[model samples]
Target: MGERYLKSVRLLAECLQGFERFVAEPVRRHGLTHPQFDIIATLGNTPGMTYKELGERTLITKGTLTGVIDRLEQKGLVERARNCDDKRSFLVRLTAEGDTLFRNVFPAVVAHGKQLFADYGDGDFEQLDHALRRLRTRLDTPGLVTPGGHVPADEG
Candidate 1:
């Protein structure tokens, strides 16, 4: 069990680090941090989303989201409007400049990232994808003891 844990943890970390290295240059060239790019990418195609939805989609925590959005707002890239249905929350969306940036950067970054995997056959991708989903399911099972040495309150 310990060996399985170490291998899986190291494998996931290595994959993430490789991808970050692959895409980091392009993201920096666009004058954005990795988290900023993540928020922009998540908000790209939609009209808008609430902070909660944005956080979920971007995998960014609330505290980080607010600061990132603040910087983006200062750059005149993104704007937030009062969520009419939920007066306490805001609907965040890209401004015209942001939309332009997204149109350019999204495809550029994706192309660059794809180049790293260009040699992989379709079946290779499929196998990895299947394995990742299986691992995610196992990790999300309730009552499972996590690396923290306590049962997670919920799958989340």
Candidate 2:
């Protein structure tokens, strides 16, 4: 079981790394890092979100989010405004330039990414999606498996 688990985890990580590498080219061509692109994509069509919301939406960690936003601000691609509802926190939104970039780059990157999975049929996609979701749910559930890989027996 442990060996199988290790193999599955390794495959998952390799797949993610491959996908990132494949998609990162277009993002880099547009002068953005993966996390920067993530932030721009998240804030693209909306009115903006609080830093907390932005942090939640993007894959970036809280420690890294501020720095990414700071870089985007310096690039004149995004702006931060005082949230009317919460004076203490700020709302982040894309600038006109950033929106334009998102409109152009997002679709292009997505199209490029689509090529990677062009061979996958509808059934393949459905199966992959279902399996991934099931794995995610199991991982998210608490106390299903302990750190040592033992399932706790219920105490009556």
Name the weakest run of 10 consecutive residues (lDDT summed) in model 2: 147-156
lDDT of residue 137 for candidate 1: 95
CA deviation > 4 Å runs, candidate 2: 144-156
* Candidate 1 ranges with C-alpha deviation above 4 Å: 146-150, 154-156
Candidate 2, 81: how far from true, in Å?
1.3
Clashing pairs in 2: none
What residue pairs clash in candidate 1, if any at all? Answer: none
TM-score of each prediction: 0.89, 0.87
Q: What is the per-residue lDDT of model 1 for residues 67-152, given as tens digits with 9 covering 90 to 100?
A: 99999999998999998887999999999999999999999999999988988998999999998999889876778787877777
Output the number of the lDDT-best candidate: 1
lDDT of 1 at 76: 90
Instruction: Report the lDDT tens digits of candidate 2 across residue range 4-62.
Output: 78897899999999998999998999999988999999998999998889887775677
